[model samples]
Target: MAERSEEVKLLGMWASPFSRRVEIALTLKGVPYEFSEQDIANKSPLLLQSNPVHKKIPVLLHSGKPISESLVILEYIDDTWQNNPILPQDPYDRATARFWGRFVDEQIYVTAMKVVGKVGEEKDAAVEATRDLLKLLEKELVGKKFLGGERLGFVDIVATLVAFWLMRTEEVVGVKVVPVEMFPEIHRWVKNLLDVDVIKKCIPPEDEHLNYIRARMDRLKLKSV
Candidate 1:
């Protein structure tokens, strides 16, 4: 009910990279917020009401109004808080950033869901598909420190899944999709991205992600059997 611009409340899950995006954005911009961790399995009333359509986590409640979806929330944060700009100053560059950000979220992250907890041929195919996508991203990262070049921005935020989540998931599933030697640029970009204090703080501990993915992989293995 508070109307203060800084009264940002994020309803998120600790293991979700999407939730991490909002947290990192807020932290990078120096905007303080109260985080309410949600249990997705049980589904909280607040999360349902805030995002009734999808019932998803990472909902941003700003001054009583809720904004759903991680990418949209990132844009809103950048627009509302002008100090730490996430998008580019030039219109064309901003459009380019948005394009790759959306590509990473919709294409890369969505495809990754199929690879995790999967087995046999399906898992192999998924990994190959996901790798193809990552190769394109690696080309984009060539000759750049981050997606936006020199600093982190929209594309970098969306690609955070690869920087943090992918490695942990690979360990849990006992697979190697994004091999550092193969995707050297992405590997380097990931290290550079995580070096930032905000990103380092917001990224869930590797063990936490490992446990979560291990549980999911176990369930998938049982189902396959």
Candidate 2:
């Protein structure tokens, strides 16, 4: 692999939001890179070796060096490419962007996962927690067209799934995780972002994405029973 040092590759999964994030950022920046679709369940040796810590997809292999974690990869892409400028330029603004980036990935993303795969009191608590955290994001998007302003940036890219994926997840599970009536601002932001031709192209087809979610939820429900 030594000769492949200069080559850029992304190990990803079609259904993975993390993978989707890196793909969108790369496309937006006009960076050329090869993509290797990973079978997440079967796992790949390269995926394991690249991300030994978490053993996850969306690992960026740049110049033979591996970068793990989707949020971190997004920043690395921004810094390395430097053309499109994913983060805000001002010092305070950049820090604020990163701050919100972390908040979405940590607080909101984690809680959103809990909305699925649980039942009764557990599901209720998860729904409440996820909704409460989303309210914070709703407040964050109160004034901005995108999380980072007029353009999609770190926060917006990292939050790709928090809105889109959750929307589909809520539908498949028949839950109210992202009630449009309650979080108008966030939903509006979602529509704005997805409406973009570039980003829209990166997303999986609606029927395919929904079917994937529905099948996964069905499997989870069966296991629970």
Candidate 3:
């Protein structure tokens, strides 16, 4: 694998699932980087400078040039390493993998968040929609060990929400958003994904994440009231 002597830094918030995706990818690829914690509420000049458009938590700085957005960062890291390839080699297979990765973000994660953020009928609708989306993903993973198949790849990395975020969100909301029996494939995939050393190590501390979600839930409740 090629090595870069230029500095690599990750500007991120500790409890951010998006940031976790990039950290996990870099770790898997054996890329060395400095992690600078960003207080997103009190955004630093550097953070603002790095991602002026979105002002997002994760901004991967490669030799001072910034790459914003988690999914894009994952692809960039995979392209840089080329050893522990995340995306598929074949063009069609690569496109398929990218599609699922996008689905996890655009469809699954976004809808699942609504299940917790909303209340009563709205929350119920969001939960049902999320379930239907998961059903599609489960079928997609019918005979596969991972979404990327046989190993943790781009899609598996994108699923940091299932492996880490969802549980904390469920705990705070006082609902089992994704019941294990109902989504057995997702549960199994999450288990396998977390078993990987890089993924496991990149996960934020449970208590910290739990507290963060609890605070967010409290705010959501206040908003509803």
TM-score of 1: 0.94
TM-score of each candidate structure, all chains considered together: 0.94, 0.93, 0.94
Give lDDT tens digits, candidate 2, residues 5-31.
Answer: 248899998888889989899888777
**How do the residues 1-225 of candidate 1 rate in per-residue lDDT, one tens digit apiece?**
124556889999998999999998988888879999999889999999999999998899998899999999999999888887999999999989889988988899889889866779999999999999999999998999999889888889888988888867888777889998889998899889768998899999887778887887788778768
For model 3, what is the C-alpha lDDT against the true structure? 0.85
Kindly report which residue stretches of model 3 are placed more than 4 angstroms away from their true locations once superposed.
1-6
Q: lDDT for model 1, please.
A: 0.88
- For TM-score, candidate 1 versus 2, the one ahead is 1
Ranking by lDDT: 1, 2, 3
Candidate 3 per-residue C-alpha lDDT over 1-225 given as tens digits, one digit per residue, 9 for 90 to 100: 334724789999888889988988888888888999999779999999999999887999987899999989888888877888989999999999889888989988888888876768897888789888888887877789998889988888887777689766777777787788888888888878767888879999889889888887788778878
The per-residue C-alpha lDDT of model 1 at residue 80 equals 86
Clash counts for all predictions: 0, 0, 0
Off by over 4 Å in 1: 1-5, 223-225
**What lDDT score belongs to each candidate, Candidate 1 first?**
0.88, 0.86, 0.85
**lDDT for position 154 in model 3:** 88
